[model samples]
Target: MMIKLLAIGKTDSTHLQELISEYEQRLKHYIKFELDIIPDIKNVKNLSEVQQKEKEGEAILKRLQPTDVLVLLDEHGKQHTSIEFSNYLQKKMNAGIKRMVIVIGGPYGFSEEIYQKAQGKLSLSKMTFSHQMVRLFIVEQIYRAFTILKNEPYHHQ
Candidate 1:
């Protein structure tokens, strides 16, 4: 199955971008992965938080295919350990899914519409993280999960 991480805005830090790229490259060896960035909404300062999320949601929804499994990286979602997450991914892969889309919303998070469309939600942590930081974190974890699945030396128990 193809795995796609869809996020809003450009990753501003050069260091973070480099790290994300490293993991992304490693992930390509195991599965089809794509990091799709939806540009930040313009004039967000002029709009309310709800409005901003609404606009961002529109952009996000447009990129999704009906058959794609939408998973939102949400604060209120279930948190899993590295091994558990690996199992979760394996289950999806074994299910014969075409594509799995995981999304990271803008500063305001996702809109009600976006939430309604999501098939599942996952949280990396209980503490808040900058969207830029979260991008690298998720990619690295994805790489780790693949390594664990392959019995590679990249992850430790």
Candidate 2:
């Protein structure tokens, strides 16, 4: 199955971008993967946090195909160990999911509509992280999951 990571805005740090890109390249060896970025909303200074999320949510929803399974990276979502996450992905591939879209919402998080559309929510950690750093963390975890699946030496217990 194809796995895609959809995020809001660009990573301003070149160092972070380089690391994210490196993981993306590694992921290509295991499955179809893409890092799709939804442009940040304009004039956010005038909009409320909720309003910004609404606009960002609209853009995110627009990029999805009807058959894609949506998963959000939410703080309150389920947390899993590295091996468990690999199994989670294996199940999706076994079930013949055409595509899985994992979303990283804007600074304020997702809107109600976006949350409603999601099939599941996953949390990398209980502590909060910058949206930029989260991008790298998720990508690296995904790569590590694949390595674990293949019994490669990249991941440790």
Candidate 3:
């Protein structure tokens, strides 16, 4: 199955961008992976938190296809170990999912409409991280899950 990562804004940190690129390349060896960056909303100083999320949510929803299975990388979502995550990937593949999309929401998080659209939600950690850093974290985890599935030595118990 194809894996798609949709996120708002750009990665400002050069270090994080490089790492994300590395993981993206590694992921290609095992599966089709694409990172689609939705540009940040302009003139955010005037908009309320709810307004911003609504705009962001609209952009996200517009890009989604009817056949895609969306899963949000949310703070309150289900947390899984490396092995379990790998199994989750395998299960999606076994089920013949055409495209698996994982979204990284804005600083204020996703709107109610976005939440309702997702088929599942996953959490990388209980502790908070920057919205920018979460991009790299999810890409790396996707690579790790694939390696674990293939019995590669990338993940350790």
| Model 2 per-residue lDDT tens digits across residues 1-157 | 9999999999999999999999999999999999999888999999999999999999998999999999999999999999999999999999999999999999888999999999999999999999999999999999999999999999887
TM values, all candidates:
0.98, 0.98, 0.98
lDDT of 3 by residue, 14-101 (tens): 9999999999999889999999999999988999999999999999999899999999999899999988999999999999999999
What lDDT does candidate 3 reach at residue 47? Answer: 97
Q: List candidate 2 stretches off by more than 4 Å.
A: none
Candidate 2 matches the true fold with a TM-score of 0.98
- Pairs of residues clashing in candidate 2: none
Find the candidate with the highest lDDT and give its number: 2
Candidate 3 backbone overlaps, count: 0
Task: Mark the 10 consecutive residues where model 3 has the least summed lDDT.
Answer: 148-157
Give the lDDT ranking, best first. Answer: 2, 1, 3
Of the two candidates 2 and 3, the one with more favorable lDDT, higher being better, is 2
Model 1 misses residue 118 by how many Å?
0.3
lDDT of 1 by residue, 33-145 (tens): 99999998999889999999999999999999999999999999999999899999999999999999999999889999999999999999999999999999899988889
